[model samples]
Target: MQYTMPTIFLASGSPRRLELLKNLDLNVRQKKLPFTEKINRRLSSNKIAEEISYYKAKQAITHIKNDEILLTADTIVCKGNEILVKPRNQNEAFEFLTKLSDTSHSVITGVTMGIPNKLSTFSAETKVYFEPLSKQEIHYYVEKYKPLDKAGAYGIQEWIGWSKIFKIEGSFSNVMGLPTHMIHNYLVNWQKS
Candidate 1:
């Protein structure tokens, strides 16, 4: 008998996450979830990520087949007590970047994977430190990169991350949106079981 791995259906719109999975040599199919991401301001930054990812996974599971596993993820940036989600406009991006200048922020990514009634969830955190960014530099990045779609109004793989971010204390892939190391391990163990 030939055994085959179950198909993984990625229920996220993030191209970066898809790219990371592909780079890790995983078999994945992207499926956009109709669920809209809504943050609960009452939860802690870490809980917020987990809850969102869980809800996303819950929605995606309904559409998956018995031979497929649904995967959902959410990433958030926290500066001090503030949770910085995707910027609504250019001005908001500038504000977010300005606040991140010369400070450390936490990037938390929550992941959920499962079939029908069974599920597994986890979160990875990365602390990113930024060098002092001048007003000119922040403005330039906001205009050039147009990071309105990214949480914290920045992409860790972009120019701002290259020049402004000085250090990071955790998983790089977590900051990018998915914690591939953890995901890889989970997938391997699940296949063995």
Candidate 2:
């Protein structure tokens, strides 16, 4: 008898998600998708995240195999009713940092795991409180790290998070993007069924 492992396909281009998946020790293949998602303003942040995650899966539907597992995720930062997306330029990054400083915000990551006949989607929310930051520190992070590609102009694993984040109320990995514990829980059950 021969044993085989399941193939996992990551339908995202995020280096953070890739790194987290690697930490999980799974057989994964990176397939970057031009995953452009639009927000439906009528929905809440959590629903928005899950909708985008499922959309990514729908967009990649043609490429997934029945024997392989396809995982897609989307993350967003929101305060109250406003959602902050990826910064397109330095000024925006600075503004995002300024807005996030000295406040508690929500980091929501939605994940969709697809198999042969089933597609499951869920979202994880983390409350992050940032210490009051100086203008110099905010400027330094925007210039040095160039957080243009990250949502809310920040990465939890980066210097800004280390220096400014005073408290985090949920999974740290969720703030980083992929929610490793959630995925691991799903994967363990996935392997059995």
Q: Give the poorly placed runs of model 1, Cα more than 4 Å off.
A: 1-5
Candidate number of the best lDDT: 1
State model 2's lDDT: 0.89
Tell me the TM-score of model 2.
0.94
lDDT of candidate 2 over 100-192, digit per residue (tens): 999999999999997745889999999999999889999999999999988899988999888889899999999999889988888778779
lDDT of 2 at 2: 50
State each model's CA lDDT, in order. 0.90, 0.89
Clashes of each: 0, 0
Question: How do all models score by TM-score?
Answer: 0.94, 0.94
Displacement of residue 33 (Cα, Å) in model 2 is 0.9
For each of the candidates, the C-alpha root-mean-square deviation to the true structure, in angstroms, is: 2.1, 2.1
Q: What lDDT score is found at residue 163 in candidate 1?
A: 94
